[model samples]
Target chain A: MQAIYEYLFGAASFVPHGYCLAWRPDLIAIHALSDGVIAVSYFSIPIALILLLNKREDLAFKRTFGLFALFIFACGVTHLTGMIMLWEPYYGAQGMIKLMTALISVITAISLWPMLPKVLALPGPSQLRAMNERLADEISDKNEAQIQLHNAYSQMEAQVVARTRELQEVNQRLKEDVQRRTLLEEELREKAELLTATNAELERFAYVASHDLQEPLRKIQAFSDLLKREYENDLPEEALQYVLIMQNAAHRMNKQTKDILTLSRLSWDSIKFASVDLAEVVEEVEFDLAERIEESGGKLEIGDLPLVPGDRTQIRLLMQNLLVNAFKYRAADSTPEVKVNATLHERGAPGTGGAYVELTIQDNGIGFNQEDAERIFSIFQRLHGRSEFDGTGIGLAICKKIVENHNGAIEAVSSRGEGAIFKIQLPTSQPTRRNNDAGRNEAI
Target chain B: MQGVTKRFKVLMVDDDPEDGVLVQKAIASAGHKVDFQVVTNGAEVLDYLFTEGRFTDQSRAPRPNLILLDLNMPGVDGFTVLKQIKSNMDLRRIPVVVLTTSEAETDIVKSYDIGANTFITKPTSFADMIEVMKSLKKYWFDSAQLPVA
Candidate 1:
């Protein structure tokens, strides 16, 4: 070891260290200052590098930065050794430091060659800024889409709320309408019941009044007739004439009361509907009017008549009234010719399948004026004086009542000095009682 | 008239005196040998038929051959009287006729339903009343046979 050291420091000293440099005090001071400054700067550089490494813990290639810092420190130490050689020949140490610096330099250079591509592949500042700008743009577009979706959701919610409110209002209106209709129906039912009661009461009053009225009138007629029968010779001519007038008035009043009673009793009780042969009714009526027909020289002809639904008694009365009217209204010169005919017809709308039997009684008699046709059906409505006709003028009215009771209709067609036709239409099948009751209520 | 040697005793039950008098006159005019006795009200007629109250004397209230009843009265109307008479064994043999001013069909049907022998509506005129009475006399006193009391 001593030999090797002697070889490095004895004659192999390339520049005889400090003597070859011609070292003056000024040069020595300058070199020492320069070396001191470089040494300090180098140490400071390493300290700064360590501090930076500590602060930037994420710094890339940390091993390479550490190696560069160690090399620079070795160079500053070599400079310090050069300054020491001017004073003492520590040539061996100086040589060793220089060699160490050369070795570090060579190692740093070789390590840098392999790290070149890695450093070049890293992103530069401009490239990183451009990528950040693109990310910001994408985030902005996503935010815009989210805002549009939120707005659409809010609009749909608002429409749903509005539709729900509108439906609630319509439902409220429908509820009110249903309530109003129910109230109206209740009122109508009450009114119908009241009207039915009133009609029954009126019918009862009519029946009672007619019946009571007939009682007193009968007494007057009976007593008056008794007086006339037993004491006619005792009375003066004028008094006898007065008695005759009284008798006539009483008889007329009695007839009127009886006719009123018949009219009132038409619908006084429940009707029993049955199928009646109209031909049989006509025959019975003809039998009842036989004497009158013979006296008036009236010729009666009957055609085909149908069996109709009606009350048997009421139909007989209706036929009697019509026949009596025919016989009573005969012409003064011509023989009364009466013809009765019937036909079946469809009633109401065509497809309804409702049918009726129409009976037409045509007469060759002293027909009334057409204007009085409607008036003739009114009770006690006389067209001629008592001298011209001996009737209470209630026969047609009774006929009309009977026809209405059977759910039938009667119409008269006549002209002055012409024949009259009484057309009667009766339903073949009885309408329901409810329909008849409704019709009666309307008439009342 | 067969089996009518004695005059027919008729009891007329009425509410109105004028109606009762008129019925008597109509019967007389019908040429019937009838002795008519009038009771003013339906209750009095019942009393006479049962021989009770004011009609306790059997000789004065003899059994009538025919009883003419009026339906509408102040008390115990003709329907009740007829019911009572037909239910009693002693009075049921007498023929009861309903002679009323009521022309209502219900009255006629009810009278016949309660064992009335005949039903007749009182005519409004004296002539018509006489005719009806004549028919009644012909049917009851002349044609119809009566049970011996």
Candidate 2:
């Protein structure tokens, strides 16, 4: 131990390094300058490494860099020992510094060589430039894709707006159509109400004509008859004739009033609809007027008849009036002959509705003038006096009313001394909600 | 009416005075020996039937075996009076015959619907009126087994 300590600090027994240069002043001076320069260069490199390590602590092989700095510092110390030995005979310290430099160099090489592949595995400048170019291209591609996505989003929003606008327009059209339909329905309801009012008025008039007005006529006829019967022997012949004439007039007036009432009672409101076979109705009417028809020497020629939508009683009344008219208006020379037939008529006009059943009643009777054809359907439109044919001139009028009540049309064509042809068109099927109003027809 | 001795009481309702007089005369000649009474309005009919007001006396308001009702009147019409009489337990048994000058179908149907035993359209002729009265007496007083009043 004493020897090793003497060797490590053996400067007391060693000569100065200037003796190895044989005491040549110029050589020693040159060696000292060279070592001084090398020492300063080595120390400056270590300081630069330390400064780089302090600033870039994240550099790879940081411990290896510290080892490299220690190696360089040891080399700098050896160079300084060389420079110091030339002046201060510190050969032991110079050799120890050289040994430390060698040891530090060995450690730096051991650490640095193990990490050589890792340090070289880092990207070179050209590879980093290529990666930067590739990342730039990818960024541009992403930017383009984002632009396309934005355009698609905008387009989708625009389509939604257009669709919303179209739907709004359709909704508006539907709203307008609904409003128009509501208005049309309201108008139809108002017209129906007006028709009901007119029917009520007609029923009231018929009631007054049938009941109140007939009472006075009845009383007139009754009182006059009683006076004539009770005072026949006491009264004068002319006075009795006057009473008889008055009674006859009253009776005629009463018949006229009753016919008017009948015609007016065929109001549109009091219609009860049923599927009535016209043939059956005609048979019933014929049965009712059998005596009259036989007395007039009239014959009925009934053809195939169809079932019509109508009130049975009203249709019977129609057939009866028409048949009576035929039998009553017969020629004085020739007997009456009546033909009744019905035909199916399809595709009627809009005013007449869908389909129709056309009935024709032809009669060989004494006919009226052409101008009176239309007027025959009017009330109290008699062609002859009451004595000629005992009628109140309301038969045709009542028939027309029956036909009109059944949503039908009636017309007559005739000539003087010729037969008459009556055409009646009726709807095949009646509307279900027909004439539902209960009219105010009261006995006065 | 052929062999029975008890006289049948008949109540006639009429608005017209002449018509009432004619009915009374016709009933007199009907030969049924009917105790006939006449009232001008439907109120008097109820009054007489219920024996109220002036007809509170039993002698004045004798219950009739038959009631001849006039349909049309100025106040308390025949329909209202008939409804009351038919609904009443005491007066419902009496056979009510509705007679009216107005021979409308509505009046006839309403009369029958209101429980009239017979609906008679008043005849215009006096002879026809006499015939109606005779037939009414024969049907009500003789033929029909009416509830005793």
Candidate 3:
């Protein structure tokens, strides 16, 4: 468009000075081409502007189309005035037409600058739609990110509150535990004091009982001996019977006193544990009871024995007592047989260390009923009459006491007329000082 | 009980009078004459031995060659008296024998540790007491040599 403006101005400058320049053939031919172009522009540009105005409701197009219409009208005026200059060639007609042409060209050229920028800068609908979609996606993405950040912040706050609550609960529990422990310690001290007083009382009572009973027993025995020495032949059978009965009663009382003493002594005895060789202990027990075993025709068989921590004297007493019971209660018509076997057992609740040694002493004797199993270990608790079985009923009780003192367990599984099996499980290690290794747990 | 004692004095520390009479009879029946002096508690024994309080005259309270100590007594037990006697250089030479019903290991060990010459668990029957007295007499008076006090 600028190139066309430059071409028109160059042709207008060629007219001779003060002559009828508009009448020149070159100017006339240029004017004719300019007139035709302006007419075509007047029709075509308005039609194009109206089409645009019809498609869009933007009011900016109305002003733009108005200015373009004015450009076409001015060009038409310039072409008509040029024809007037050509017919009136002499006088100031030529200068006046040239100045008017220059002025109209300059105005048209300035107006067209704004139109070209508007036309080139306008975008297609597809491009505009794509840009709108991109802006919408960016806003939604930012909203999603903000929502995620808010959720994460709330989660962190909840975690902090929960952690603080847990800490407070733990602290409260610890305080309660300390209070309970103090109360327990006070209770334990009181119990210890009471036990001391009770022990002293028991000691005094035992002393008085033994002394008073023995003093009367001494007089009776002395008088009886004197009677037997002085009037044995003269005394009647009934009198002698009376003396014997008296003597038996005295002996029984004496035995009862000794048993009571033994029972009391068991509590005061010191516990001494060591690595006891079970195999040797069994052999010695069997050999010691050889005479009774042989008399009962009992076959005593022992399996492999494992070493365990225990008091040797107590263990020996325990084994001796069990063996004696087995031989004494043998089946009437059958030869008694006893089997002693030992095996390593996994540590249970009452047991400690890596493993425990369970020594099972099974006897093929006349076993008591299952109901009598627990009763058999009670002191002086007899299942049969004295004539049926000769026992102080203390042996099994002593064995049970000894096993318990060693921190072990003993149980008897038996059925009437079958056999009794006494199972003893002892840990390989002795019980250690509980608080010495504070952080360590017992090896299970 | 008075007639049973003729020669050697027997000091009996017992709370019950019946028990004291029984011991006097048992000692007498053992075919030995003893001068019986009965005291209810361990304090009386100490008084009689040291000639203090009720027994102020040293000549009437004869020093015994053998002392029969009971393990349990009211107000200062036999063990405490035994400990006092053993710890005293002048009194340690006297033969102190423990005759008590309690055969508890603690009592036995403590009695022995306190320098008791012999420990005898009291029998429940009278006949056994006679035998215990006889043994006590034979072992303490004859077998064991007495140190002149």
Estimated TM-score for each candidate: 0.70, 0.64, 0.61
* A334-362 per-residue lDDT for model 3 (tens digits): 89889999988675725454567888999
* Residue B93, candidate 3: alpha-carbon lDDT: 85
Ranking by TM-score: 1, 2, 3
Q: Sort all candidates by DockQ, best to worst.
A: 1, 2, 3
- Could you tell which candidate, 1 or 3, scores higher by TM-score? 1
Candidate 3 chain B, run of 10 with poorest lDDT: B1-10
lDDT of 3 at A363: 87
Clashes of each: 0, 0, 6
Runs of candidate 3 with Cα error greater than 4 angstroms are A1-122, A125-270, A276-307, A331-350, A360-364, A378-381, A392-394, A413-419, A432-444, B1-9
Clashing residue pairs in candidate 3 are A217-B125, A217-B126, A217-B127, A218-B126, A218-B127, B5-B34
Q: What C-alpha lDDT, on a 0 to 100 scale, does residue B54 get in candidate 2?
A: 97
**Top model by DockQ, which number?**
1
- Candidate 2 lDDT tens digits, A1-444: 878767766778778878888879899989999999998999999899999999996887788888888888888888888888886776666677888888888888888876989979988889989998998999999899999999998999999999999999999999999999999999999988888887677667675767678887877877786787668899999999999899888888887887777776666347667789999999888888889878877799999999988888789888888887877787788888999999998868235567988889899888888888999999877789867888887788889888877778998999998989899988887764345346332221
Q: List interface RMSDs for the candidates, in order.
A: 1.3, 1.5, 4.7
